[model samples]
Target: MLKKIRWMAVVLLTGLVMYPLPLMADHQGAGQNSTLVLEPTVVTAGRIKEKKSDITTNVTIYTREDLEASSIQDLSDLMLKEGFMVREYPNSTISVAIRGFSTDTHGNDLSSSVLILVNGRRAGTGNLAKISMDNVERVEIIRGPASVQYGASALGGVINVITRKGKGPFTASLEGTLGSWDYKKGTVSMSGAVSQFDFDVTGSKSSQGDYDTGSGSEYRNTGFDSKERFSFNGGFTFLPQNRVGISYSDYSGDHIGSPDYLSANDPDDYVNHGIKSYDVYYDGQTRDDFLFWNIRYFKGKDEYETHDGAMTPSRTYWRDTDSQGAQAQITAKWAVAQITAGWDWVDYEVSNSNTVAGKENTYENPAGFFMVKTKLLEDKLVLTGGGRYDEYEVTSDTGKVKEDDNWSFSCGAVYKITGELSVRANYAQAFKMPTADQLFMLTDYSAWGMGIWSGNENLKPESSETYEAGIDYTRGSLTGSLTYFHTDFEDRIAYKSIGGGVTQYTNVQGGTLDGVEGSLQLDIGAMFGWDWEIVPYGSFTTFLEYEDDETNEKFQYTPEWSAAYGMRVNHVEYGLNARLNFTHYGRHEITDYEGTGATTLGPDTVADFSVGKELFDMNKFGKIRLKGEINNLFDRDYALVQGYPSPGRTFYLGLNYTY
Candidate 1:
């Protein structure tokens, strides 16, 4: 532990000492002034508009331009391309580890410690596969505990997806893509604004056939996946600084096949999943710009069913969940300070198709928060502090009920030393409550000849305290950042097996996790008169200590290092662009239940290349774009997790037309 602390101190000191050399360079390239800053305004950091350099926490933003420049087609593809620590397998659920914290294990609910939000609202489930890539405006990645802004499930970090809204005249677009493995996708979208109203709508469809791995071996039960999605949003303005809006989204997946692990026989495992959400909100600001308010109501449903082969009647099950929530927040601005107070409530009901009648479970959570931001030293230094409290209760049909309460707080500061550099530090305490399944589920099941399994009524919330420090530097066309973070956890939740095959959810003693993230961006075209850009980034995470050694066993699934670099070239005169990207993952050790060592799984490399061209332009009809992408350029055969090999080299071609 002492060695790790010393190492982090050295890295921080080195970055600070070398921050000023780049500021003295001449700015004479073509786009030096235009590209001086690489970050956009983000809201997830403080619930207000703030630049990346002004925030005390580490954040990464992906804009519309960033999405268009990559070959990614979904949330899974984007995470992998951005070099985030993630676990994904074909036809299986995907999970993301934020600073080495995630809720992944056998018999667990597959929920994540990292919270996922859409437009500042919790998105119910943790399944990343349900998110659609179409009609997205930006993505913000907050890389530290955010329990003050968000409540439970925020013990790690936050990922927020912001959707686009209409501003000017009506515009419509159509896009289609075709790739290997019989993969196909199409989307249509329209957006516009009238005298007192604005609207945006999008619809998409996608499907894929079975594929083979790089080893030239067919992976059975890798079956097919077909999905459809539709999203709509509209807003009406009644007066200045006042507007009301409504949004709806629906997604469905049909006959998604899962790989069979028990045997190599034909995969008969399949499932269908669906999600529907509706939201209505009002945004207004009082005169004199002293007060602002936002009130919202949301309702959502998620359902899924799984079944094996036709001959296996015993291996079938289905679950459905419904959720409703309401949020109200008001902010006041005074001299050199801003204060925000908010309250929210959520209710959930879970039902099973195979369970007995009247066996459903219900859960409810109510929370409130207060936050304040103060500016001092002539606006060169900023301080932020906030606290939140949440109370939850669960009820089941079998006359069983449980309740608990928790509170969290966060504080941070950012100081600007020079125009080209800034320093920031933060401390936060976060927590995650037990899910309804962990408290009310009761089923008789056997795994590998094990006995019955049932849920435990007594469980405690998992909590953590995080400390972070970082520095950001930007000069001419160079942008870079280095951040170090550490977290200490207590009463961590885990699924354990008692005697007589009675497995239940319990709390582990404690543990410590720490990591460092660094990034470097250089726009050669805007600095050295070159016609290209280069970006290199990397992150490292490890377990520092654990009260119970078995807790460290699960850390083996997390890789020690992940790195990526990409180079892009663009010719404005010719309307052409091309890029090459490479990503690498360090070997990860697999361990047993008792923290004993096992074989390693990863230590792989993959590459992707893409090119795009503008075919033609019309004054009123807009323009046409043609693109081609190749993934797995070297045909690398590897998997981030065992028993799942990635597909070999694949090709894709796409076209987009706007009017």
Candidate 2:
């Protein structure tokens, strides 16, 4: 069986590396306004920089333009458009399910196993992986075990957010919106360079009333989310072969959570807590003809609070999270090969008040690791391999606990077939150590008497081995990628409540995921006075669970298939912008059939969208612009999660003026 599996992996890899092509074109992108496009671009793939084509892992990127056209209101709005991803928030919260591996289809859980970053810095949230886009430039999402690089949680991969930077002597833009459900939003940004030192700053605010479910209930979504943010990113070349840069960002926000099945009009609506965060980072690089060195340090803090009173059965919990870390690396490139070696360390501390216990408890975990990357075959064939050794030190407020050790590594290569096409393949072995709650939680009474449970010191970390292959093709006006990936997971850890508010997290053995994704874009030159951009995309995902009898079954919250189609048009001076998109999601199992949180068919989603725009040229020294958007344009009502039905027809109008 091992030999057969190995052979299949080799064949799949060969197919991608041997792509056929006659001609290819360049990809159109930003950064042309000023910054030189560096070779071997550094993308947030595994918290590491890599060439786009050389990336052998499963990943996705959403640029500023993509977000603008899609007009994503929040994380769910963004994930919904990425056909390869699955998102559901049964209780008006959101979670991510990538490549068929997911904890809950519901979005409310912050502990979804997906790690999130801002400007290469970590942010904190309890169960839900939440982020703000006040000054976001792009978001890169990588899937599969990332514990080797990002530390705890990242068992599912990582989401890295890159912020905006200055391009010229001075630049500024402002935006605001008014829409249904008493919605309103406003944003401002300014940036410029003085000498060789450049900087960018931004701030935004927004709010919305309850959206009527229009589902025969008085239920209205009562989410009023607002944020205030500021960030500065600057870098300067110090010596002939070195540069130093630094960034600092801060944010505070509050939002009223909408009840799952109730209308906003209810006087007894339960309010979910909101979050606040701050981050700081410093980076430096030194490169000579033969050797290179890079280093970075990051620190972040997150606090949570409720909008209404103190706490209750529904409030369930209260908490604070803080994370601090630093990493450094030294590498060299000789004629035959390029090599890299690095080290990283992080510390995480959480303080919480358990709902049932009503007693404050805390947990602290610290860890460290090392890794490397390389190449071979006269540079025509590239190969990379790295390993990480980390120790998890867990401590409780009451006493000391056990320690866990993990070793992880990845080996992959991409071969150039033609300048326009390339096929690549890689295999990785990784592991995820259990979280504090998974190993030390004490039973709590809640949720219709579901017995509460705690963690197990004797528990073992879950492990996985994944193999993937992909082909990338690019040509004038078009670019695309197709990938096939699979992972065999052992000892999946999950939190479960037996009944009566009591809960205990445990591990179940034997799981696997298989999926394929293909995305392509076509841009047409000026036609009918408009520049046209069209994209057709799709992804297929399925998870197999080895039941108690070791029989393969369906995993929860993972979709069988999903797809999307989009069209966009743009005109220069007149500033006419428009887009239309359609997305479809196949069936998914909500939870285990006989275990907890079970469901027959998790809700599927089919959405349609359209937006239009126009811009007014500068008026005297002031500029004015107008825009509009109509979502669920057809008034289609759907559910992104089981009980959490999405919004109905909604429209937005915006006006902005600048001096």
Candidate 3:
């Protein structure tokens, strides 16, 4: 793999030298430059943002053009692309394993290594709440442990979604989609100024029929998700040295019918799963030449209720979870160097999950950090360094564990050889804290009759350091990048079996991961009055052998090879868009461990498609649009999850109107 990557790099550099291309063709291309949302996320932030020309720790930026051209609805759409491991559940819910950490299963508690963020705010996971993309401006995927700054859930990486900021003329955009299998969706958005205040409101609702398992069997899928989002911003430019602005957003949604367990042949009896969430956030910013700071606070609550008909005791399980956090950050630039510092605090509470008694659970953690970024070597080389410290206390039914602390730091530098060639490298430390289940979810399934396997009150924290580097070169008509990364996890958290079916949560020493991936973009130039492009990409990851130290048996649900690839087509006017997505997975080992006799999971492939358009442009007074999308385009039968097969040939259509 290393040799192959080297060859690709040589070819890329030689090609660039042979024929020069626009350094920012995507940026200078007609019809796209005016799109502020498409601008590099660093538009305002002083940080020297990552560009396609340099790779440091795997990161992918999906532009507004890519989103619109590909007709993507959510993260699930990324499944069609290689490198991303997406385990599809009924409906649109999917657990993504970007860069191999995903174990080819519907991501459950600790099943994924990625963190999903919306507008720099913490988004809850674990069947509680999910991040939506209706008003998303762009998505930033940082592919590695971000625990140094993100915390427990950010084991793999971070997905930062920038929301659409209110700007530009008083314009409105609307769209409608309608297609197969009782699929329908409606969307409406309007933005403009009323007096000195500017406001933007965008909302959408969608529903669809239960999808098939591609084997002609239905998984009892009949689930729908809906969200209502609104934002208001007020700002004023008071001369060359002053500016202030404030913004607020609120979102709420629901996803019904997610079960704890469903058998291959008995998918009918396992029904009744639901999740609802609400979020409210407010932020304000003030800036000057020498200094600036942004302050924000977010509050989120999630309610999850499910009647797993097959639950051991037929429990109508319910859990209520909420999080509140505040952040204050300041950035300053002085003599070719920019310094950023910030502090964050968050609290978590969970109310009952398995008992109708409504028991409440809670935990609190606080963190602080500072970073310095500088432009060196005549502003062509960039270097950054930062460190973070976290302290938290977890209190549960068992008892209280206190005095826990974690530390992480990172440094990186990028060198531009020319306007078109750049090279970069980075290193970061990330980790995850113990969850409630690990600390206290006890079980009596053992003949020992409710024996206890207590939490490690004095347990040391799990830690990891990642090293990554890459070079990117692009010339006219062709663009390409290569990225390579390696991670070493020390004292990783794990559940070690004690005896008689009971297990204890503890940290294990020695875990390693290595990966290499990249993507290529080619613009065939205007063909027949149409600007066209073809993007091809792939990723590969190797999870070193992991086993129980005591028994020396392999861990469950870890696949040796995880890889993905796809193509997209777009036409600006006339409103046409489409994609051919292919997903392939190698074999994996399942739980129910019995030495090397574990069950084999997937090593399969499947394809899917979608398209949409604006019906009429009758101005902001009113407008309508139509769309159609289908999953499992080829209807190939396959299963990414153990008995639960995926949906086949799913179709949807939606309509939107605005006034």
- Expressed as tens digits, the lDDT of each residue in 1-659 for candidate 1 is 67667755655565465445344335455444344444578989877676777688999898887788655666667777777766775664677767776533211222568887888888777766777768788899898888788888777788888888777999999999999888899989999999999999999988887777888777776656788989998999898889899999998988877775312435767777878899999989987889988999999988877777675573477878788899899999887899999998988877786345767677788999998988899878989899999888888756588999988898999999887778999999988877666776666667556556566677788889999998888776567788878888888777788877788778877677767777766555655555454333333343343233354554656666666677777777667888788777777666433232547877888888988899988869798989899899888887766766777898999999988
* Each prediction's RMSD to truth: 3.3, 5.9, 5.0
Q: What local distance difference test score does each model get?
A: 0.76, 0.59, 0.58
Decoy 3 TM-score against native: 0.82
Q: Give each model a TM-score.
A: 0.92, 0.83, 0.82
Listed per model in order, the count of residue pairs whose N, CA or C atoms clash below 3 Å is 0, 34, 17
Q: How far in Å is the alpha carbon of 356 misplaced in model 1?
A: 3.8
Candidate 3 RMSD to the correct structure: 5.0
Which candidate's TM-score is highest? 1
Pairs of residues at least 3 apart in sequence or in different chains that clash in candidate 1: none
Models sorted by lDDT, best on top: 1, 2, 3
Among all candidates shown, the one with the greatest lDDT: 1
lDDT of 3 by residue, 201-260 (tens): 666665555556677756563444453444444454444333345555444444444532
- How much does candidate 1 score in TM-score? 0.92
